[model samples]
Target chain A: SQTIHQWPATLVQPVGSPLSLECTVEGTSNPNLYWYRQAAGRGLQLLFYSVGIGQISSEVPQNLSASRPQDRQFILSSKKLLLSDSGFYLCAWSDYQETQYFGPGTRLLVL
Target chain B: QQQVKQSPQSLIVQKGGISIINCAYENTAFDYFPWYQQFPGKGPALLIAIRPDVSEKKEGRFTISFNKSAKQFSLHIMDSQPGDSATYFCAASTGSGGSNYKLTFGKGTLLTVNP
Candidate 1:
């Protein structure tokens, strides 16, 4: 069975601070990884997706960026966080563009 | 442009009642439709999915009705329970090629099953 793990399940940061969220999947290789942000009472917004290592496609133009360092390791980072950047971030993986499996998610609050 | 649209921003149903959520899409190129259930503070989980080729698909107590020509689909929950209370999101995606791998999500519906 495949399992996805995310770190710092919850975080509180001040404005202009750096942000880093990690996502790793075990038991799968060369899987499609995606980064999504869900604002309160709003639909999910796709931030980034990667087909392979070093290849990242950004869906929205924002301060956040995503990188797939290893086959199953994806990271979402930001040089400086904004108040609008606060939301629940999710990491998902799909095997052939079929169903996507999401991680536990990281809740970030920028004060 | 929102590719997919879902109705009933919020729904309150008593236990043992039926819960229905409707979703519509404008893009004819979309071939895949999926419904996800999300609990508070948790990630959305794939509950059920249907393709354009199928008119309807049922899994356990959950069912997905797809109308190809109407470009609409819906989810039906039979004998709803309190555990079913959660936020439901409907999503659609095109399988063409390239960046089409991403799924466009709806605004989401908050379902509350009163016990």
Candidate 2:
């Protein structure tokens, strides 16, 4: 019964603009959260993951940053967006070997 | 080091045919293997998964064949349909790390099924 939500479903921003994408999970508590970016026809690249509040592990070092202020709330942010930052962003939650359930995803377009 | 490697950057198959995608991993610690399906504009969804302890596991038209000794796993889609056309990803992870375990994914394979 666990569900994940992400927004804005789609985004368009000019280069160098600040960005913020939010993800939240319902029907589950204390689940591991992850942020992934996937380019068109490409595999997912793990950006960040958190096991609990205030515990963020970054998988890739880039212009983006992640924060876990609450147990089920995760935010992906960037001070200045780059053309390369545009892609499909996904938020997920998992427990043990159970499959990770992904949200609808955010399609970011940086012009 | 990249722990997992997936082959066939892309594949095309006709309806009712079979689609096969392969993946290999170097880390022996990986016990859980999973296959994910992604549409053009959607996040990857968990299609099926197999644990190293099981040689094979099936769910509907999708199956996962795992080879523990070879450190390899594969996804087989029988009776392929156009709706199955999408990007497929193979991922491996170990719960041995407990709460810190994170999935390590392969580059991915793109599958296209034509009617």
Candidate 3:
């Protein structure tokens, strides 16, 4: 069985502060990883996705960036956070473009 | 034409009643349709999915009905329970070998099953 883990389940940060959210999947290798943000009452918007290490694709232009430092590790980062950046961030993994499995998620609030 | 339109932004149903959510897409290239269920403050979970080749697919109490001609699909929950109260999102994807492996999702429907 594969499990996805995300940390700082909840985060509160002031404006212009740096942001870093981590996601990792255990029991799977070379899986497709994705970063999504869900605003209140809105559908998820894909921010970034990676097919392999050091390969990241941005779905939409924004302040956030993603990196696949390791095969199973993905990180979402921002040099400076904006008030609009506050939302529930989700990390998902899929095997061969199949069904996606999401993590618990990280609730980020930029005040 | 990548939008997936969903209807009934919110729904309220009583226990044991049936819950239905509809979604329509404009992209004919989309071959995979999936429905996801999300609890408050949580990531959406894959509930049921259907392929364009199938008219309907049922899993336990959940079912996905796909209309290839209309470019529409829907999810039906039979004998809905209080636990079924959550946000439901309908999504479509082109699957592998096209554009990118990203899903285009609906705005989501909030389902409340009153006990």
**After superposing candidate 3, which stretches have Cα over 4 Å from the reference?**
B98-100
For candidate 2 chain B, the 10 contiguous residues with the lowest summed lDDT are B94-103
- Which residue window of length 10 is worst by lDDT in model 2 chain A? A94-103
Q: Estimate the lDDT of model 2.
A: 0.90
Model 3 lDDT, residue A12, Cα: 99
| TM-score list, all predictions | 0.97, 0.96, 0.97
Leading candidate by lDDT: 3
User: Ten consecutive residues with minimal summed lDDT in candidate 3 chain A?
Assistant: A93-102
Model no. 2, DockQ: 0.74
Q: lDDT per model, in order? A: 0.92, 0.90, 0.93
Chain A vs. native, model 1, TM-score: 0.98
Candidate 3 per-residue lDDT, tens place, A31-64, comes to 9999999999899999999989999999999899
| Best candidate (score: DockQ) | 2
A3-111 in candidate 1: lDDT tens per residue? 9999889999999999999999999888889999999988899999998999999989999999888999999999999999999999999887578899999999999
Which tens-of-lDDT digit does each residue in B38-112 have in candidate 3? 999888999998889889999999999989998989999999999999999999888757434688899999999
Q: Write the per-residue lDDT of candidate 2 for residues A45-105, one digit (tens) a residue.
A: 8999999999989999999999988889999999999999999999999976557889999
lDDT-based ranking, best first? 3, 1, 2
